[model samples]
Target: MKKRALLIIAGLFLLTSFPVTGGSAKVTQPPSQKEEIIYHIFQRSFFDSDGDGHGDLIGIRQKLDYLQQLGVTAILLTPLYESVYYHNYFATDFYKIDPRYGTMQDYLRLIKELHRRGMKFYMDMETQYVASDHIWFRDSYKNPQSRYSDYIIYTDKENTKPLQIVAGISDFKGYDGVTRKLVMVNLDNKEVQAYNYQLFKFWMDPNHDGKFDDGVDGFRLDHMMDNLDNLNRLPHLFTTFWNPLLGKLRNINPKIKIVAEQANWASFGMDYLKDTKIDRVFAFRLAFAIRNFNKAELIKVVDSTLIQTPKGKQQIVFIENHDMPRFSDAVKADPGKLKVGCALNLLIGGIPSIYYGQELGMQGSRQNFGITDANDIPDRQAFEWYKSDTGRGMAYWYKNGPWWQHNNNDVPNDGISLEEEQNNPQSLWNFYRTMIRLRKNNPVLIGGAYKNLINNNDHVFSFLRYEWGKKVLVAVNLSGDKQDVVIAMQSAKQIKNLYGIQPVISENNLAVSLPAYGVAVWAVK
Candidate 1:
């Protein structure tokens, strides 16, 4: 591990010639809720090191310059713990780093490097279930004499039949044949709770140092819900597990942020936020509405979500994530629509998170279930770092996997690679970088209150972000044709053009002619 770290640092020195947009300086203060712009990365698909065709922690450390260049203040990484699956959500061991992602030393170096660059790191935690190979499951399943016999929920005394829960109406039970059946943890047991608490604490202070600079800044709790297994088995989960656990974590680090991924995205996670005291939750309703181009629905959902959320709490605004198709693919890879989506995602009230490869407009849809072994591989394809499929840094580690056979490896030459788009002024990558810089420089856009502006045109969605006598107006045209719309705002002035069609403000009513899928943002005082 020490040798690997030395090699990674040497590689980073050779790449230091690349220009970084954001200055290199260690941040004295921790990132605030208002100033966070998170970029999510799937480690396996990001960049490879050791020529192993698998992305690792060292790879992420090497790309800190790229992320800093994009103007993101924080990074949300997928799970890095040991798991049999490629995604690593179902952890076999919570304390160990997956060998494919590199050693524990590599992870520590990555965290230290991120902090050195004034960036925050958040990790995804899926502690609800464990892989069949997990010690808790192995010992408890069909082994009454084992001390961990009560650690997992089982249907029979002999423990041959593990209790399965209804994931959804369509799926009666949840399990992957590769891992047999994932055993859901018995959170009711005191010993089980202790294990999870220790696991969380270890990641937060891996070296037992007083300072947490080498630890994660926050966590994204996956598939979090009030009811366990959707069967009301653990109805008091918030009271029993979450509140206490969060209280302990807060005692350790009060600034730690915990965001929940609601089991059902259709409904607001108000219960979890209020009861569990989670810091944030994903705005899935808005994401779905935006992807479908439901202009009215999008506006309505955004309004309700922002209005209903309690003060001091936050929503994680994103277009796509590891579990879903990329936003570009969702909109059929139309660059115009992708730009509009990015505009809304960044300009909204919540902290925006950009999924990896989103800025380059990478396109790949998840294959339909039952048709492929690993349906999600297409969506998690290697980042298009270069024009060629087998270029350096390409993580085609799953080339022998079934999903790779159906993967979208034929990305077009134009508008795909960072090397290509970084040079093109109007490319999607530039659009994201420019918009992010704008948001970072503007205080109103980052921490302001949201107000839905009245627009006569149904296809045009407009809003205002105002705070402390400062205001910014954002208008997005979701349609494929030009539209003239009047925005209702007082004392509005066009200060700058963030992206898309430039707006023209006249009096209290702002009138702008927007091209197809156009976006305009203005600083109004």
Candidate 2:
């Protein structure tokens, strides 16, 4: 509150002609509406501290200072439960931490360190399916009289054949080169729902002392859907299964936030917001639109996304994620397009998420390796921490394997590693840092409402973010050439450049010039 006057005064009298702001007016937004900048890390691909090639919890703790300096408010990690798979998605033991990732003490220490620095930890939880070795499946696979028989979905009346998971199959080869059996859980059963609630609650308050210092702040629900991949087995899940379980978890920790990944990427996820009332959802359509670099597409997607979002909820915007292709490969490693992507990722009206290696412009695309989950390994490669692959903390857990043959993404001396770009001022790493800092310093950019602008040129994508009396305008050129566009003001008569090249006023119109793939932010007067 004390710095509000100085900030407002600094924003005014900014080398332009506009009405002066005075009197007792002030700007503020609701606490719930304030968004978070999250850094999404693949647990096994982040960094390794024990020389085990696989990334561990201790590695993440060691890098907390680096992450804190990057200005992200939170970190979202993939599932950490014990599993036989490389990605650790299918849990063999739901209650134990994966040995490859470290021990329970390591996980607890990571949470404590994260909370100690005011950073939240959002654990990725997927309780829908388990591997063949899970206790529920092992005991009840062919034994109908077992007490846990109803815990898993069985095909025949005798409980001999279990229903398949996502791909409608009983088995899938894991990254460990083992074709392990899999089974979908009977989510409709009340017992299964109760188990899920308990699992979620355990992560929220591990020690259960009423203090969450050792627990996660929230959960990232993976592959959350109503019908479980539209297999029609668990119908009306949002109303019958999810709502009841989520309500109980919220009751325990009222401040806890849950982020759901809507199974259908093409969907606007309005139902997830309106029905389940989740805190945030991934903006998949906008991520596709950003990669296309089409101004009309960007305008339409951004407008449609914001309109569909219910009040008090937000959309998480990003160019790529664990399942998506790296943005560097999508743009052919073009620096300008990368900068434009960074600007929109942070400045858009939503909570922003940055994939682990995205800041360094690392490249990887999903490959079709015929069979198995090896195809997605390129998208989840080890974080490039040095100019060369052989480094102390390099978490190349998939190296010296058949899958590594296809991963030409991590070429040496390619200027993609953090070590290569850490000192370069014009690198993508610096651009991301600058954009994050700008978004943090400006309150309007965090909680302001988005309004698309109608510029003259089709290559220019412009929007206005306004809260209370403060307004900020962002314009990005999506083309490969220079562009000039005029923004007609309805109320404010002038615009002052705050983050990029300055613009001039021509008969009440704010005409701005931009370089190829240039982005600028202005303080509207």
Candidate 3:
């Protein structure tokens, strides 16, 4: 069955941007902030000034030029709170920045520099649990008579939970949610809900004003709807936690964006995420779309997702992210297919999220963070800084030891490095550059309604984006053999070439012959 969906753009101005007129002459104003890109800074491999081998905020500041060169306008840094382990999922404290990553002064400098460039900054917050080393935990553990003991939920009758592990690392030594050995407040507990609320309040209260600081505009919600035994299913948990958080944040900053980490399609949270209050949703479905699909098959997935997503919220699009296998690893490390996948991500709806090293074609299947053998951190190799030299000076900033090793052979020094792509116009870097520029040039592509063009085609996939009476068609050929596709358009003003396989002026029907792994973009006049 075909689903019809409509996306109404809000708080967005017309593309026919007018110049400011002061008295009589036209005056130039600052460019649109909406056009800026948001780069998710993993911070693990960003830069290391201290030579301690982990990326820190200072290192991130040093690499701002690289991000700016890529035309990125914002950086979504992972949690910087003090934690005992890597990834920092388990927070030891919410009030201060981790010393290993750098002092608060470094973070302030990063914000200052980014703001100077007219860019935005967002920090990740994990409201799940505190590490065993946290002051709250210490206080609760050391003093049984202290009032802080109420922060942790313990059981005198029975033990329902076991030892806790942060991000799959069992040695984290955290308060288990299921077992009561070290009591961690159960998310499902109604009595502890207030405590969780206070935790969030404490995390956002920078001035200790007991109020959230409005300077932070957005958040990268980590493991948002996971590990909820008593909280029930995804939809229920979202209503239980997300709605409240959204309400609280909106009461302060109405423009804040909430990006949740829940990826389940069948879950009700998927439907709830489309709420108008939630501005954007992370496109988790793309990770499952690997070498298993042809161009035609990929289109169906995109169509289904577009239909399911709420019209008001944007879908965060991407080909590869930190948690998933690298795009290069999907096509059996085929660089050509990687370009096609990335192109599709850029052309699709929502904000495009580029993972670290994806631009340079880093390769890995999965990773073992030295815990379980089957599940591991794959493709998370250190960045190769030199174009020809062996990795010598590349350093990471976090003092905590990394769970995984650099597994891939591709580095900055190799021929397949980012440096090579930047110089070569035909390289994948230019392809991304062109794609981003195309998205910006065509307002219809950004704020338009997405409609599937070809439903049952075997080798070709196509769709049309419509807005402001403008329509743009995007198609991709993922099959190994060449195939012709019949395009559907309402008018005779169809023009293809800016992002498509060939130039065509279709009067109702357009025929396109697509090569394997080829992507095309067309516009309607």
* Cα lDDT, all candidates: 0.78, 0.83, 0.60
Candidate 1 TM-score, true structure as reference: 0.90
**What digit string (tens of lDDT, one per residue) describes model 1 on residues 1-525?**
122322222112222111111221111222233578999998898999778999988888888889888888899989999987778876789888999999999999999888888889999998878868889888877897889888888778998877774442211111143424566788889998888888888888898885898899999998886788677767678889988888898899888999999988887777776878789999988888889786667767887777677767888999989889878778888889999888888987788999998888887787755622277877888888886666778888777745656777555565588878888999988889888987877877887777766655677888777665566778888899998886655544345655556665545566788899988887764
**Model 3, residue 408: displacement in angstroms?**
0.8
- TM-score order of candidates, best first? 2, 1, 3
Q: If scored against the real structure, what TM-score would every candidate get?
A: 0.90, 0.93, 0.80
Quote the positional error of residue 321 for candidate 2 in Å.
0.5
lDDT of 1: 0.78
Q: Model 2, 1-525: lDDT tens per residue? A: 122311222113223222222321122464235447899999799999999999989999999988877788899999899988888888998789999889999999999999888899999988889989899988997799988899998989788888878867788887677797888888888888888888888888889897989998988999999989788988789988889898998888888988999999998888899899488898999999999998777877897887567777878998989998899899998999999999999998788999998998888888876657788988898888888866888888888777898675458888888888989999999999999888876777888777766666778888877776677889899999998777655556667777889887665557788999999998887
